[model samples]
Target chain A: MHEMALAEELLKISDEAAASAGAEEVLRVGVGVGWLLQVERQSLAFYLEALRRDYPRLEHAVFELDEEAVRVRCRVCGEETEQAGWGFACGACGDRDVEVVAGDRLEVRDMEVRTDDV
Target chain B: MCETQGEGHQHRHLEVHRHAMEANDQVAARLRRGFAARGILVLNLISAPGSGKTALLERTLEQLRPLRVSVLVGDVETERDAERLRRCGVPVAQIVTAGTCHLEAGMVESHLAEVDQRELDVLIVENVGNLVCPSGFDLGEDLKVVLVSTTEGEDKPLKYPAIFHRAELALLTKADLAPHLDFDREELLRNIQAVHPGMKVLEVSAKTGLGLDLWLDWIRAKVGEKQSLHV
Candidate 1:
C-alpha cells in the first residue's frame, strides 16, 4: 500500500479506538514500533498533516512513537541486554545464541484523551 | 492541582506533553489501514549505498512481472532508478527527496495517488539507500526488508542491528561476488540470527539469478496471505 494509504488506515484505527473509548478529543497517541521498520518520521508527519486536514477531529491529535530497541537475551548466562549499537553479543555471557524478546512492535500503546465531556 | 502566578494573576496551567512526531504517527496509522483494506502487502527496502538494492529490485520485478507488481523508489535526487524500473513495464514512480535522507509517509502517500492501488498485488517502496536514519521512521509498511550485500562484509549486521532486528526478512544480496570477496555467508547469517532469531534469511544473486526462486516464492506467499485476509 502507499504510505498515504497506510497513514490513513492508522488514523482511522486510532479514531475508532478513541471514539469507542468515548474520548472528547485525542491529545496524544502513543505508538510502539520495532527497530526493523525503517520508518521516515518527517514523511509520516507530512502525511498525518494531510489526514488531519480531512478529519477535523484529529486536528489536535498527536502521534508519539516509542521506538523499541534491539534487545538480546543471553542463553548462556540468562542476561538480557540491549545492543550497544548493532552488535548482538550478550553483555553478561557474550553468548551469540541470544534471543530477542521484544523490539519488533507496532501498536497503539495508549491514547490521552480529554475526559471533560464525560 | 494548584496554580501559582508571580503577579497573582489567575491563569490556567496547561500540561503539554506533545510528541515530536505525533502527526507522522497518525498518518502512518492511516497508511496501514489503506493497505489492509486493499489487501496490499507493502515492504520497505533499506540498505546502504552500492548495496545492490536496485539490482535486487530489477531481478524481483522481472520475476514478478507475470504477477504485475509495481514499485515506488525513493532517491535523494535523480530518476535513474525509476527509469531503470520503467524498462520492465511495471508502474513505477520515482520519489525524489531532493535533499532528504529518507522517504516519509507523506511522500509515499502523495506518489500513491498517481497509481491505482487495486491494480497492484505487491507494492515495494525502495527507500533511500541509507541504514541509520531510515530505521528510525515508519513509512507504514507491512514488512521491512533490510538488504546487505556480501561485499559489504559480514560485520554489517552487528554494526546496524536495528535494521536487522526490525526486519521481518533480511536479504543478503550479491551472492555471486561472495567467492571473490572475503564475505562469509555463515558469519553474516550467524550475526543476523543473533539479533533476529527465527528471522527469514534469503541469499540471492541478482547477477546470477541464484536464489531468486526462493525469494519470489516467499513474496508470492505474502501476497497470497494478504489476498486471503481481504476475503
Candidate 2:
C-alpha cells in the first residue's frame, strides 16, 4: 500500500517531466529497490498499471525494476560485506554490530519518454 | 516523397531513471517528521496471530493510564482490539487491512491525520499480527517491539530471526503460564539473546500484572526521551 503511494508520486513526477519536456507519451519508468526493502515488484507494477490507466497520457507506460543487495559495514573490523539474509554480521571479523550502509532504498532511477510531437 | 520521408525519420528515446517508491518514502518521512515534531514516540508491534498482542496492550494500557497514552491498532478482520483498548480510557483507532498482511507507511500517515498527535504522548501501532510480512515494511516508527509468548516455544526467534533481530525490544509475554507449560524461560532468553545480544528484554504477564511496573517504567522513559528530544 505504501509502495503504491510512492509509485503514484513517481508517476506524477513522470507526468510532470513529460509535460515539461513536451512529450506526447511516457514510454518507460525505471525504478531501483533495495534488498532490505523487499518490496513485491509485481504488486507495485499492478497498482502502477491500474493507476496509469486513469491517466490516458500514461496509457502505455512500461515499468522497469532494478534491485540492490543489502550491504553492511562492520563496526569492529571496519570491513564491509554484502549480506543475503537478515544476518548483519561481518564476514571478516565475525562482528554482529554492523551498520547497514545501503540496500534499503526505493528510488526512481530513470524514465523513457517520447519527445516526438504528434 | 514517401520513401524520402521514411528515410529521413529518426526515432528519439528519452532515458529517465526514477524510483517507484520515492513518493511513499516522502510521505513516510513526513510522518516521521510529524512524530518527531510532536515529541511522540511511535512503536510498531509485530507478532503472530494469538500471540497475545492485544492482551499485552490491554495490560500495558492499564499500566500507562497514569501517563495518559493512546494506541492505533491494525487488524485484517474486526475492530475487536480497538473495542478492547477503549476500556483503557485512551484514544484508540483500529485499522482494518481487509486482506493485507502488514501495515504500510501510507496507512499510518492516514491514521495520523485522523488522530490528534498533540493530545497523546505515546502512539503504539499493533501491526496486523504477522511477524514475517510486517518486518519488511516500515511504518515510520521509532521502535519495533516483537512479542513472543512462552506457549509459542523458544525456537520462535530462531525461526523468525528477521523480525526478532530487527526489533529494538523483545518481550517475553505470558510468563505466569511458564510453570504450567514445559516452556523454558532460560532457553527462550538465550534464543532471543543469540539473535539480538544486549537487547532490551521484558518478561511480563499482562494477566497477572507481574513485571507490569517495569514495562511501564520503560514506556515512561521512552516518552521522556522523546519529550526531551524536542526540548
Error of 1 at A94 (Å): 14
TM-score of 2: 0.78
Expressed as tens digits, the lDDT of each residue in B153-229 for candidate 1 is 88887787778877899988888898898777899888987767678999899999999999999999999998899
Worst lDDT 10-window in candidate 2 chain B: B1-10
- C-alpha RMSD values across all candidates: 8.4, 4.8
Q: For residues A1-118, write the lDDT of model 1, one tens digit per residue.
A: 1335445656776676656655556667776665544445566667777887666556798888667776878888888888655546788877677777756445566666553421
Local accuracy of candidate 2 as per-residue lDDT tens digits, B94-209 = 89988877888888877776567778788999999887778866788889999898899889987887688788988888889999999988898888887677788998898898
Residue A23, model 2: Cα distance from true site in angstroms? 4.7
lDDT (C-alpha) at residue B186 in model 2: 89
Which lDDT value does model 2 have at B41?
84
